[model samples]
Target: MSTTIEYVRFESTDPTELAAHRDGLVSLLRERYGADFLGAHLARSEDGSFLDFLLWTSPEAAARAAREMPGDPGAAGFFGLIGEVHDMRHAEVLHSTQV
Candidate 1:
């Protein structure tokens, strides 16, 4: 069984600094997650409210990665954007026949 994990996060203040930080961070994720990664980036307005989605190889791995996100200067200010960071939701697909 393959597990797919998804997450939705909201930011109150969309500072350009935050945008720059996340942009760099996502690029790093590509290198790390690779083939198991699925990217969905959304920006609703200029004020900086946005949502990002990701699909991971396994729900467990996703959860772990989120917790242990690479600590870098760009990541340092990430949590400041939101008053709360919700836990990522996930599901298991026994058979995903793509046809």
Candidate 2:
């Protein structure tokens, strides 16, 4: 199955607090999704917004997480820190490489 890249772009009032939740969020995803949850990355833009990327084994897995994560009690703290979500979407990875 092809991998899916889920990206969420948002603005947060407190980047530090939002960053602090990274490990917890990742742990929760790993616990819930296991190997299907490949990895995650968080980046800050020059405009002060943030971009979050989550890699999943498939689109189904990505969609499942999107459907379930919001209702997950463990994600509340991380979700609460986001002031606004500009965009969220998933794209199929055509190619990837490690060097």
Candidate 3:
């Protein structure tokens, strides 16, 4: 199966707090999703908005996380810090290279 990438663009007033919460969220995902959760990256744009990239083993895994994450108690703190979600999307990984 091809990998899937989940992208989320959002704003957060307290980036520091959001970063801290992100650690816990990542840990929770790793524990829950195991190998299906490939990894994630959080980036801050020049305009101050944030972008999150989550890599999953398949589209099904990404969709399942999207459906369940909001209701997961461990994710509450992470979600609470988001001021607004500008966009969210998922796409199949066409190509990837790692050294």
Candidate 4:
């Protein structure tokens, strides 16, 4: 099985706005990324920055999702207002006891 993980960092002048935009972004991802394989997390960092973890079922699925990300759709600068970096990693499952 393939596994992918991303650590995303987002910061914005307005945390509430960022949270709202993030909700929209997640919705878009859920629609395009396929079923039974998409997951995400959002947390407030010690520095008050937002940390996001997005997990997918496979590396290929992650890449495909990346390529298929929805267009701005008038949501310009959404991420810039909330996040800066999206750190990502891809790997294969060598072993696993739980899903």
lDDT (10s digit) by residue, model 1, range 1-99:
366646665664555666667766677677766766665454544544555566677777676667666354455666455544433456665655547
Model 1 reaches what TM-score against the true structure? 0.60
- In order of listing, the candidates' clash counts read 1, 0, 0, 2
Top model number, TM-score = 3
When summed lDDT is taken over every stretch of 10 residues in candidate 3, the lowest stretch is: 79-88
Task: Quote the RMSD, in angstroms, for model 4.
Answer: 3.4
Q: Which candidate is the best by lDDT?
A: 3
Ranking by TM-score: 3, 2, 4, 1
Task: Answer with 2 or 3, whichever has the higher TM-score.
Answer: 3
Residue-by-residue lDDT tens digits, candidate 4, 49-99: 777777788777876755555345634445557545545445555664646
lDDT of 3 by residue, 9-81 (tens): 9999999999999999999999999999999999999999999999999999999999999789999999989
Assess candidate 1 and give its lDDT.
0.60
Model 2, residue 74: displacement in angstroms?
0.5
lDDT of each: 0.60, 0.94, 0.96, 0.66
Which scores better on lDDT, 2 or 4?
2
State the lDDT of candidate 2 residue by residue for 1-99, as single tens digits.
Answer: 889999999999988888898889999999999999999999999999999999999999999999999778899888889888999999999999989
Candidate 2: 10-residue stretch with minimal lDDT: 70-79
Q: Candidate 3: lDDT of 18?
A: 95
Which prediction has more favorable TM-score, 1 or 4? 4
